[model samples]
Target: MDTRYITSAAKPEQLPDFDLPELAFIGRSNTGKSSLLNALLGRRSLARHGRTPGQTQMINFFSVNDKVVLADLPGYGYNVARRDVAKHWQPMVDTYVRRPNITAFLCLHDCRRNFQELDERLMFMLGRQLPIILVLTKTDKATRNEIRKQKEKLKKRMDELGIDYQVIIETSATKNQGIAELKALVLDPHLQVEDENS
Candidate 1:
């Protein structure tokens, strides 16, 4: 569980040279991307959590055990982003996603809220390009019934939209729920992509 900070890139050209398999964590603001990263890497604060929405504005990379690279992308869909970040967010993300080393995308979604249009649009765009696993974050805050209903609704909506996802994982960084399973998926060399029918 040795994780070290690498670099933060505000532009595509600034990205470091890394041959390691990379997993990008992306989601809407306040979806707990940093917290889940810390939990998954077994480090209390390796990835800094933003106290305010839209505070993370760059692509931050980290080396986990000298094995894989964890890329922390800034959260989207926040109205309060700094003007510069807002201007550059789209292109930076666009380039990063197309990088040859990206192994998978871990799309975090807050379990307490219903899906938004941005969620659908982002998933639709990414679905055809790379394997995406929808991570239902902050599950500890919701009741079991609430989580179940939300999952059902999300699946139904994805089906209707024809948005394909590799898997859906319920995670609670605070409670450490499903962290091990998620870690296994990320580190597994032969990460399997399950069809929508399965």
Candidate 2:
């Protein structure tokens, strides 16, 4: 019923060896990924809170009830002067995205800014492979009217992309809204296995 932070690892090989489903969280820098994680778990300081925009350079793994795994992926966005450190991210992140255990990816985009060129490019590279659920972050900063308008815009984009089983969810980690529905859609059934034990 509740999700919690398990661990943070730098390398993919260090990820815990378990067949449990993995719900990965990904987004652009300053898109409220860390805050959303804490909000989803109903805790304030569960995931490392960082002030720097592009702070999550390494991949973080969080376990949920021993049956599911929540992976906190590094945020993708331009960080002036620190570009070299993130050189290895896109490729490595792509691999993990394509991995079989990746039940679903929460591809967050700042609602204030429409999805960017980089986001579009990554979506193309993914090539209809992994199931992705787009999360519109930072709703608390916008007016209700503005949020609805953005949702319509993003919906049109998804339709144009022909992405199947994809969904767009609006959330404000600060407001604690849309957290439950997002979890239900991605984490619950996406990774659910037909019980072999059954």
Whole-model lDDT per candidate: 0.84, 0.71
lDDT of 2 by residue, 22-106 (tens): 7778777788888898888667887776677776677788767677888888877755247675666755575677677777767
**TM-score of every prediction relative to native:** 0.91, 0.85
Best candidate, lDDT-wise?
Answer: 1
Question: Could you tell me which 10 consecutive residues in candidate 1 have the lowest summed lDDT?
Answer: 189-198
Pairs in clash, predicted candidate 1: none
Candidate 1 on 65-169: residue-level lDDT in tens?
A: 788888999999893236766778888888888888888888999999888888898888888787578999999899989888898899899889988788888
Candidate 1 residues lying further than 4 Å off, grouped into runs, are: 79-84, 193-198
Count of backbone clashes, every candidate in sequence: 0, 1
Candidate maximizing TM-score:
1
